[model samples]
Target: MSLRGPGGERSRWRWLRGLRARLALAISVILVAALGTAFVATYRGTGTQVRNQIDEDLRTDAQLVDSRLPLLRAKPGEIAEAAEEYLDERALFPLSARLFMVRIRGAGNISNLPDLSTAEGDPRLDRDVAGPRRESDESRALRTADLGFSTVRVNDEPLRLYFVQVTRGGRAVAEIGVGESAASVARAQSGVARTFLVAGTVTLLAAIALGFAFATRLSRPLRRMAGTAARVSAGDLSQRIGSTGPQDEVRVLADAFDRMLDRLENAFARQRGFVADASHELRTPLTVIRGQLEVLARQTDVTPDDVRHVDEVVRTEVVRMERLVEDLLLLARADEGELVRPAPLDLAPFVTELFDALTLTADRTFELSDVPPGRLLADEDRIAQVVRNLARNAVEHTGPGGLVRLTVRSLGQGRLEFALEDDGPGIPEEQRDRVFDRFHRTDTARARRTGGAGLGLAIARAIVEAHGGRIYADSSPEGGARVAFALPGFRAAGKRAAKEQAAKS
Candidate 1:
């Protein structure tokens, strides 16, 4: 879990689990498919088009040679020379374009250039072209003027040739063949294929590079978060991932982790502080008991007065220790957020009974001045505890001659305010906020003398809050301390009104 742990190593993957690897692979596949499709279409499409153009040119050139050749005036022997001169003038065929001509001299007699037989090139289309291509090209050309069209290789190179029989007035005066080389068509198509291959390869390489970079940028925060989690789980609650990336989903997750860490750190602080405070509070009473008992144990000539004083001192410490333990237990229960069973009660008489109880227990003047008619939904015991705690606080802080008053007033909307005001000096404004903190006491001398652990208001606050209410402190209208709290009221208006009207009757 530490930084030096194996968590830093990249986990193994099945081909594409890594974001970088998946992205690169996906990009490469998509690009290769698309470009490969385009390349195939271009190569085949261009090849077909070029071959078609070659065939058309062969047909056009054969027609031109047929109409322009002067076979009507040329004598039998002069026809070849005239046909060659005419072919050169029209430039219908390039040097690579081979020409073949045949003239019928007499019955069943055909003649052509003696050199066409000597012209050597494609082994297949060599001198044997006129001899062998004769049966196929001539017979077909005899029936149709521009019918001699065929694609064949000459000397292993592609060539296009056609045979044309020159005529005058529909009667054959001479026969000729014209052809053109088609090697350039194959070359052009091959060049296109090579270009596609090179382009596709370069594109795939570039896609790999870009895909890896994008995946890293996206997964970077997640990697960092995983590492942070490992460290945190290893007991490093202080570890935090600061907001470092753009305001994306990953950044949002990091922010949430930071908030959780803040809570964890605060919780740990409170736990440690609770332990330290408990130890300090318990040590004081234990030390007093130990010291008093030790002294009693050592004194052999102790009088009844000395023994009584020691016994009383030890007993007092034990009583205070018991009270401290009970308060701590209550706070612990409250901290656990335990729910209280709630029931309805009339507020006016509830205040009256607690007021009567306080009058019997304390010397201060106690009054239930104004008990407004209302009902509140609360745990009856817990509410009584809160009232008693506040009442005790008011009595303890004030002298014998000082006054204490308890009042409950309806605030409408299922709420009532209960307050205890004392004639003693009120809590300071700065200390008001922390007054309910556990073990916080302002009057150290009084705490030591009367054994008050300063948990009365804290416990009261806990009980009130658990009942879906709030408790706070402020100055009273009577110029003394006022500890007040609010609870949900369950007073029935109809019942109270009926009782009031009955009393009138």
Candidate 2:
């Protein structure tokens, strides 16, 4: 139910557990929440504004009754008879308003809405609010605060009441109450609620559908990547994918995946080559040993010198086999790509010692240049081995008296480039790129003369890469082979050593 994020944290949404589902749900939640909030705010605001308008109309009706009563008191013998005709002569009120009256001279009353309380004793009105009935024209007006405003109901619908009390000689003569219809306020509020419900439902459905489609589209590249990964796991590294959807993170990821596949394909090819070349190289020596042993077993009078010569030959082949096995083991380990542990080493003396040792092993005109004065961080043995292999490779390819130069120089990017340059026929252009490939040789004749299964350059390349450096072959200025490798320079090594020492402390 929980999805893992890029950082490996469990996702917060429990029900919407997948990444796409959560994305869709999140967008939908925001949309629905926004719509619901707007609906409630607008509905409440509309109800409040309409109710205020209705109250204002009720106030105006009460004021009209007050104006009509004063003239009636001066017009006739009784306030009731003249007020009745005056009420009939005028327009009733707006559809929202109704009229109610009480004669203070006696307990008589009339109302446009019969539901109105009369003489303050009508059963429909609350006894506590209505109080005792008015018995005479001298009935004192109710308290000033309670005189003009009240609440009532008719046919179960709520109403607002505003009363105007009339008096003669400062004694109460009559009272008029104006009630306005609050029913329309309820109806307007209902209409708004219904409209919001319908609109919100439709909008929510649309938002959910769009969110699902958007999530699907965004996840398409990821789904394709997953499929490709499954195929890769099943041993098919040749499958490739690129910028599947939009030019975004997914596209960038697809490009990177393709680069990774390229590397995998090359590594796997090297692995296959390693196995095949090892088998072929080992078979020849074993076959020679077996044939020589068989011939010696049939000899009748083998001399001590002959036996010693046979032993020497067998020993030489055994040593060669041992070296081949060791080199293969090293290459196998390199394939795992573990870190290279480098320490501070002086290149000046290191290169001098290396040249002196290599010249002793091969007959060639060796030129040693002054090594630059700076210590670099390198696995001293591995660096020396890489140089030794290149020198040996140069020795094998060049004729007798051929010149070979061992030089050290700066590469301007905190790198020191050490190269073995030979003054012999250089490698052809087509073979340059494959020079570092395992078991690669320009031709079978050269491979046999060199007595190399074509692993020296491959081993050198692997060691160079392990040091976070690069190795390559090029034509020197003298038109001969230039096999070089560059590692991190001395300045960076000192800084790195200092930081490591500080961390330990």
Candidate 3:
């Protein structure tokens, strides 16, 4: 439920939870992985091709050396001279120089060709010529060592070497190695690696940024929908999420939710209006009935039994009509928002007066405690009526000789609290909330016996809330029901001292 900040621990992995981000990440990983794989494969294959070319050159050089070996053996001193002429005529391509090394089969027969004595040359050839000789039998059929192409240093410059051997009729004759500088190859490979790294880094960063943007786009509509849902749950049925773009699934869902809210708001409005109209319509008839009953009760020459029976019926009907009229008026006033007026008045005197009046009407003893003279900005009459109704309800439900207590206290700030407790069976947990609803009754038989209506608590709630307060019913610490209400308080103006006031006057 708490908000998160970017760069926090959870932020790093936030993208993984979002659908758009996950899809973008999946695409980016596949692209980079495939590209990196292809790059490596191509680079390695090109390197192998270059090396193979060098090997082919080495093989050809070995064959050429073998073909000229008879000529060299017939003229031993002229071998180096012939090698120089051959390299200058055939191997001296642009930026290319072929160096040769020749060694015999003797114990110390290592030798560099006489014409190849310059230090500004391939070191790879010198390395192959100067290193210990390979076993004579291991030489390839063309009398070549088949030394694969490789990079090396020559006079402080990188170079490539290709080595070949010479044999005469199954006996090792000599070794010949050739080499060329490889500065271009090294530069080319370094450029390839750098290019791959730069492109990959830029691509990955762009993918992450784009993924975040898309995720925000997708989450925006959902966040608005969530806000609308919260408002609706809080009883604000006027709110709704507006649709966006075309009629996709999200838009369809939003439209449905808006329609539902509209229905609820209309239903509540109609229900409130009906209650108000019905209460007004029933009041005129009840008034006429009560007046007729009053006239009948005053009739003369009536027998005592007949009088008693007629009086009981009249009283019962009066009580029933009065209860109905009171409930209807409460519902009407609640709908019209006219039940309470905000004003600064003391509540202790009001509660005390109400308890005194109810005590005379009920048999149960009423105890009052902690009745602080707190000032409140509420309708004093409505709050008193609420207190009276709750007291009467408690007294009717309490057993004979049971106790009813009223308590009032300041709740600090601008709030005041009042609670009425009784020694009676508490409301069931499941029915506690429903007890405030209109026409809800827990004891239908008891209500009939006592000539009680079920609208007392419901009316009390409407009146309390109309005063900008709230009421609730819960189990009391006295093993009975406790009904409580809280209202905003106001401070009374202090009285001026008479002496100071006289001086000013």
Candidate 4:
């Protein structure tokens, strides 16, 4: 039961609810999903590739260490010197050494190498080579072990181990073993992971930004169309949305909507014109008929015994029908914007003349008050018709010995007001606005009894509005209904007089 638009009436809901936000969210979700999947795949692939490269490097380093061992063991007594010479001659080798060497005789005898202090280029290698574990069977086996190169955990630290066997005169003499820490391989893998992580983050942020921008661009035209439609629904047919391009659906929709509004505005304009024209055309006939009927009803032709009662009924019906036709004609002219306006006329004198001519019933008293010398530009005949109609309506509603008052005053700033007050039953608040509609009578039974066609107020309103005025019904101070009308004051007499002269011409 929600109301809509400026008038606060219930209306249909529109379709453009958070369209921009929904588009943005949908596009963002899609982009994020796509980017996330790609990032995960690329990151994993890169990590695997980097790890394979690191493993290859580790294996190559191990192989290089293994190839250099034969020459070192050729001179067992001078092994340290041989090792130093080989290390200096090798190219592109990433080998670091923690060495233990052992010598064995043909009869299964083992000899631990002495701390040959004079046999090395560096004293640290010489001292480490002369440690006591060089004589152990396990150390001897490791030196001769033909394991080319392998990664193994030693002392809870990953190490690359390479071993080479040495022999002299066809018998085993000594063996060489070398080991290097695997820390470099781990560092390289970590670098690859960091690079992939950074790349993934950047890709995700860029995707989100692009998604939002695209969504906004797409929804902007739709928003404009929605706004235009809202204005049209609120009775503003002049609004139109800008079209983007013919290739876009929203632009096509906007074009269609504008066309529809054009048709609607034209239809309403025609309807108003028809009503005004029909009302104006009928007024002359009704006036002629009413005048003829009045003349006939006043004739002092025959005796009361010879006069037919039907004649009285016919006169009454003619009056009622004339009033209805006059109301309809006025409404038609007002709707068609064809009502005439004449030169400025003084309101005080007009009100006095209208009251004097109305000839209220003997049972009711007609009173005038608050008369003002306000000048208004209008058609004299139409204004007189409105005043006369209001006065007659007041007389009909007033009770016996009741009061009917006509008031004309200045409402300041070039505005003149007219009010007809009657001491009769006041109209209900809810029915006040509709009282000016054709065929609308407050007391249906009484209207039927009095042969009223219920068109007096409607005609009065049309004449008032045709002169750029407004009329309404309200509560009177005398506990009855007050009907009021107002008109804009006079300007230069040229426009009004010209229009009146044109109508006459």
Candidate 5:
């Protein structure tokens, strides 16, 4: 009942439960059953063939005796003696074929068994006294038939006998019988069985060996992949199957497994970097606040203005820390796909409100493009957050009165595109993609205090992607940084409704 071994470990023969062993066993069993069936059919067929040949030989002997008997033209009383003399002169019977007995029935019964008789109790006994009773019973059974064949036992061994009645002038003259021992049939069948036994056993063993080799070859790649997965589970992310095998389903699976591990390794690396960056970011604000507190604590005499200055410094650092923490939490929830609850949001009004808010926030030459009349399936607050982050980044890069432009358009087939351009030092081509990575700053020389925690673009990317949209950065037509995002699932108004909306705007 309990299959476990000592110390609760699995049994050593558990390998037999693997795919290789099971496949090998299935092949072996199928082959063995086929061989067994063939053996039974061949063995029985051999015995039947040998016995039939013996019967045919017995019939031929009786026919020969019948053909010769009419030529003699002997009376019924002398026919038995004449048949004996004729068979003796010609030596027609074959001893080697086990054609052991001949009986001719006339007025007096005559037998050739005396010449072929063996010792008493022999299996091939052909003497008259040893077989008269059984032979009479067989004769009586076929008395009404002109010709027949039957089996009789001599010393418990089978003998096949053939009998035919001989006639002259439309009158029965005599009856002839020829008998052969069945021993040769038995010997032939036995020899065939022995041969098949050896051949089938050898074939079965070879099949098992070949089956095991094929199964091992087929499963080798899978075993290697399993080993690599085990190593990965043990925290060795560098482990790889590195499959360089043939192009089959197994090879495809191995490649897919390796790709999954590559992604997992990259994710873990990003998580470690994100944590380190967050800690460093939080530490800077805490250090500033702590230093201000320490300075105030050291002074024995402190003015109201001095206390107020420290308070401002502390409050500013705390606010900065709070913003960073909130951004980090938002990114964390985005990873779990729980950041946004979407609804139908009108784009034109949202973009107009955003433009006004941006103009009030900073002194810049803000330009607004034609606002597309459409509704976007998105979280209103989250979309607002993305626009604000992009606007803030653009405003930070540009100087006072520098050009900052915003565009919103509808792409056909239910999609929307938004782009923001600024006239500032554009992001380098090499750093354009990396700028959206958490804590990655395009302007590395800018102080952390002024550049802010480098999570603004990263947060924007996360939120946009969570809404099933994509965000990217490029060079603006104004020769400055350009950031754009596209969102699917937009429902545009009818042409008449769009015209009315544009007139109102």
Candidate 6:
């Protein structure tokens, strides 16, 4: 039975696929490859060196046998016996030497190792050399160049052989063979391999452990961020990665993530507040309209005057609701940065027209300060809305016959400032910043009675901001409130226009 899944994939080892595991595994694999390559190279080099040393020893032994054989004074056929006698008497060969032999007369071979070859043949030895071989010793020695080495198996054991000529009285009498077992070379190479294997195993284990630890440390912050994101997706907006320490890439990402959460939280809070304010404002007007209609419906003898009064009340509430809804829509568009489409507007004529129009809105003493001649890049309709909203706000706050002033001047560097001041109860110092907030009223009761939903200043601020300008409230020199806005990218059409703006300022 197979313990495999689809496509023959292993199901039990899936946990090894995580980023940490993969990173550790990759490091370990590279290390193992490096160490394995080194081991193979070292082992092969060690074997080659040891084998070369064995051949050198055999050459030295052959030289010694060549020097001693001439002094023995043995007959041609007794040459092998005479060499064995010398070896036993003097013990000239090292214990590591596996075989010592000399050629006897009649093309026969002798050695310290027994002749294990049969008449049929010995498979362990070379085919030509196996069996009870009887060939010319000179011919057999000529198989290799003089003083050269070769390997052959003797009695089923491998040995390296060196052949050398032995001469007596300037005549070649016989040849001596020096052999050393290949096992000693094998043993030397094995010792080197064993040492490296133990060292490489320990090094690989330590490296893998360090790789895993480093991977875990590096990925810990990312795992925390993932957890935080999951919690945030579940509507826990307060969740934060809160990464601390050195400013690494992970810490930077965590900080950016926390900042994005902050923005989302604030946006959601504002949306909730906006909805609540809109509901409250709409409910009041709806209640008024409904009450007027219900009173009209319950009348037993509804006169024309009573019906007319109810109609007036209902129409008034409807208009107020309509204006509130329109303002809310404009504010919503402003939030999306789609509130304005800009064009070049002649500031002098525009401001004059604005002042003239606002003068007719209330019974206050309306004054226009000096207007500068210049062209401004603005959306004309949005600019008109901003001015109208500010003028109305000022007019409603000031008493009858109070002085309300409008001022326009060049601020230089391609910018212009407009101020609307009223001689009435001034905005409090602390409330200046919040005056432009939606549905914020200094006098809520009075503002409601006067049909002010308190969105005029807020709408004005949005329009001005969409034109790349800013609006702010300050104390007027006339001892009331001053609301001013500044527009950028104001260009003078000519040198004369520039001079006129400069002089006016």
Candidate order (lDDT): 6, 5, 2, 1, 3, 4
Across 276-314, the per-residue lDDT of candidate 1 in tens digits comes to 888888898999999998998898898999989998998
- Residue 116, candidate 2: Cα error in Å is 7.3
Least lDDT summed over 10 consecutive residues: which range in candidate 6?
Answer: 116-125
Give candidate 2 regions above 4 Å deviation. 1-16, 71-78, 90-96, 103-108, 113-150, 167-173, 283-313, 332-380, 398-424, 444-449, 462-505
lDDT (0 to 1) per candidate: 0.72, 0.73, 0.66, 0.62, 0.77, 0.77
Off by over 4 Å in 1: 1-17, 65-186, 299-315, 443-451, 495-505
Instruction: Report how far residue 345 has shifted in candidate 3, in Å.
Output: 65
State which candidate, 1 or 5, has the greater lDDT: 5
lDDT of 3 by residue, 1-505 (tens): 2454645767788656767777677868887888789779867776667666655665676566545555424333244444445555554433233545554433222223332232223443342353343422212111232455556665566656666556555555555666555555555666777877888788777877787677677667776888988988898888878877567777788788889888999989877765765565456457766776676668786677776776677676667777687678778778787777767776657777777888887789788875554467788787888888888878877877788988876555657778899988888888888888775678742445463456788888998888778899998898888999887664422333323323443
Per residue, candidate 5 scores C-alpha lDDT tens digits across 54-147 of: 8777777777666666454567545655665655754654433334233333243444444332332343433233443355433332232235
Ten-residue stretch with the least lDDT total in model 1: 107-116
How high is the lDDT of residue 204 in model 1?
89
> Please, what is the TM-score per model?
0.74, 0.72, 0.44, 0.40, 0.84, 0.84
TM-score of 5: 0.84
| lDDT by residue (tens digit), candidate 4, 408-495 | 7655556777888988877779989988876566665244456245567777888787778899999899888899998886532355
For every candidate in turn, the CA RMSD to the true structure comes to 6.6, 8.7, 17.2, 17.1, 5.3, 5.6
